[model samples]
Target: MPLFRLDASIMPATSQSRALADLVESEWSAENPGAAVVRRDIGSEPLSATIWREAVTGGFAAEADRSPAQRTALARAAELADELIEADAVLLAIPLYNWGVPAHVKTWYDLTYTDPRIAGGALNDKPVVLASVLGGNYNPGTPKDGWDHATPWLTRVFRDVWGADLRVVQRQFTLVGVDPAMDRFADQAAEIKAAAEQLAIEHGRAIATQVQSLAA
Candidate 1:
C-alpha cells in the first residue's frame, strides 16, 4: 500500500511544481491516513550522470566481466525499478527547464530504463499522476505555442510507453508574477493556477480511490 512520489525541482522552497504536488499529496493523505509514502527528490539527490551508460554496458557483459561501476549501476537501476513496481500509485512532480525536461530527470529515466521490468512496461495499468508546471504559457495560438518540449514527451513515456492509467495536472505562466515583464498576464495566470490546483486535488483523490480499490 505504498505510494511513490518523486519531485524534480532544483528550487524546492520556491517550486510551483512542488506546491501543486503538495496539494495532491494532501488530498491523498486525507484519503489514506498513515499510509506509507516513498519519496525521491531527484533535484536534491540526483543520480550519477554516468549510471545509465554503466548500466547499459553492464547489461551486455558477463557478470564476472562487468566492472565494479557497472555492477553498482545495474544494482541501482534494479532498485529504482523495484520502487515503482512495488508502489500502488505514483506521483511525479516535474518542471520544465529551458523548454525541455530537466537533465537530472532525463538521467533518471535513462537509468531506470536499464531495468528489464521497467523497460518492458512494469508500470502497466498502474495509477500515476504527473503534476507539471511551466514558467511561461505554451498553449496553442500563444507566442510560445509548440515551444513546450517537455509535456508531450512526458505524456508519451507515462501514458503510452508505460501504459499507466495516467492523469496530468499542469499549470502555465507560473512566472507571470515573478517576472516583471509578464505582469500583463497576471489575471490569466491566476485563472490557470486555480484550475490546475483543483485538478491536482481531484487527480489525487482519484488515484487514491483507485489504489484502495485495487488493494481491496
Candidate 2:
C-alpha cells in the first residue's frame, strides 16, 4: 500500500488553507482504501529553531555531539525524510501568505530537504503534486498575480536536489472577493472547497496509477 503524507501548517482550523489540507486528506483516504495516511501537523509540532541554527552552522562536530535539542531535530528531520522516501507520492497543500508559502511549511521543507543523504539519495524519482490555495487571483500574466516564487523554488528543490518529478495542481485565487461570488457567499466557499477536494483525489489516484504502471 502507498503512503500519503498530509502537511498542515496553518494555525486556525477555519483557515482556508487548513480546510483544503483536510479536504485533501479526506479525499485521499476515500480513494485509497487500506493505504497509510500520515498527517504531519506542523502547526502543532513546530520545527525547533535550534535545528535551523545547526543546519546553518555546517560544523560536523557540533552535530556529532547530539545535544538533546539537536538530536530531536535530527530525528524529526530523519523521520520526515524517511517517510517521504518510502512514499510513492507526496501532496503539499500550500496557502499563499505574503505571496509565498507559510513559514511553517517552509521550515518543513528546509528540514526535509537539507539532509544530504535523503535529498541526494532515496528521495530521487518520487512524484510530487502541489495544491495551492490563494486568497487573491494570482496566475501567469497578471499584474497583481503572477508566478509564485515559492512554487519555482519548491520545484527546484525537489527536481534539482531530490531529482523528483513535481507537478503543480493549483486551485488558484479561491477568494470570493477576487472572483464573482455565487448567490450566497457560503455557497461559493463550498464550491471552492469541493473543487479542491476533487483535485486532491484526482492527484492521489494519478500518482497511485503511475506508480503501479512503473512497477508493472
Off by over 4 Å in 2: 18-31, 55-59, 62-66, 177-198
* Candidate 1, position 180, lDDT: 99
Clashes of each: 0, 0
Candidate 1, after superposition: displacement of residue 15 in Å? Answer: 0.6
What's the lDDT for all of these models?
0.94, 0.65
Runs in model 1 lying further than 4 Å from the true structure: none
- What residue pairs are clashing in model 1? none
The C-alpha RMSD in Å for every predicted model, in order, reads: 0.7, 3.8
Name the 10 consecutive residues with the lowest summed lDDT in model 2: 177-186
**What overall lDDT, based on C-alpha atoms, would model 1 receive against the true structure?**
0.94
The candidate 1 region of ten consecutive residues with least summed lDDT is 157-166
lDDT of 2 at 137: 50
Report the lDDT tens digits of candidate 1 across residue range 38-151: 999999999998889999999999999999999999999999999999999999999999999999999999999889999799999999999999999999899999989999
CA shift of 10, model 1, Å: 0.5
